[model samples]
Target: MAKYLRNLTCTALFSMTLPMTAAAEESEVQDMSDPLAVYTQAGLGYTDKGINVKVGQTYDTGSDTSMGMNVLEIKGFAGEALGWNGRGADDSIDSIRFRNFTVDLTNGLGGQVDISWDFDSNQGSASYSFIQALPKMGMFNFYHSLDLG
Candidate 1:
């Protein structure tokens, strides 16, 4: 009985000393350095840091021109505007927006027109829309991107 007990103790100690691996709260395909919220450690919609901001500007005052936006995707947007005399009724918009657009296909083929309305102007506060009849093309090609590592 004594010899059997000794062997059992030794076996238990050896098993405890053997190396073991534990799976973290991560996966093999997930990236640890990626900043996107999809695979982030803090979970979706959680901002680890205070804030991140980016700005861009384009100005061209040549002639009255219009551009057609075929496909536009706005992944993110953050803006700041000024108010009129700090009154809620007189608040105004002086802000910037971030949007990505693919308009090469409809650039010269489609004529562009922009129309706006405002309470500050002769026209009262309202909205406008421009409709277009596009010609169909038989051949269509889709653009895509792939990341393989």
Candidate 2:
């Protein structure tokens, strides 16, 4: 509430102190008519949910432990990526994700997957974790794969 009040006060003060501009200059600020703006923000590359696609080959060694032998597998998916901003100081919002992921069992890690994200103004005490059943690690149950901030 205090922050809201402060912002409101500042906006009101700015409006009152702004110097008057010529009519021709004022006319230059045209209202945007882009219909998509109604759905997303003023300028953005992705919609409420950005897109991500991955396709990779998975080959299981004969000794996968309790899971036993496995065949060649491929995984691909698409999900919502709504809360990230590239322009401002504050951009990452909260989101929920549900999907199936795989970790390769191949030696020397035949493939590499790189996932990147950015956060601004870190004020919240949040904990993030990724869980997966690792056939590569010889585990039949899901376990903490990684921890994120």
The alpha-carbon deviation from the true structure for residue 137 of candidate 2, after best TM-score superposition, in angstroms, is: 24
Candidate 1 accuracy as TM-score: 0.18
Most lDDT-accurate candidate:
2
lDDT of 1 by residue, 73-109 (tens): 1111111111112233222322222322212233222
Model 2 Cα lDDT, one tens digit per residue, 18-45: 2222233453553223111111121112
Q: How displaced is residue 29 in candidate 1, in Å? A: 26
| Model 1 RMSD, rounded to 1 decimal | 24.2
lDDT of 2 at 131: 39
> Which stretches of model 2 miss by more than 4 angstroms?
1-46, 66-149
Worst 10 residues of 2 by lDDT: 34-43
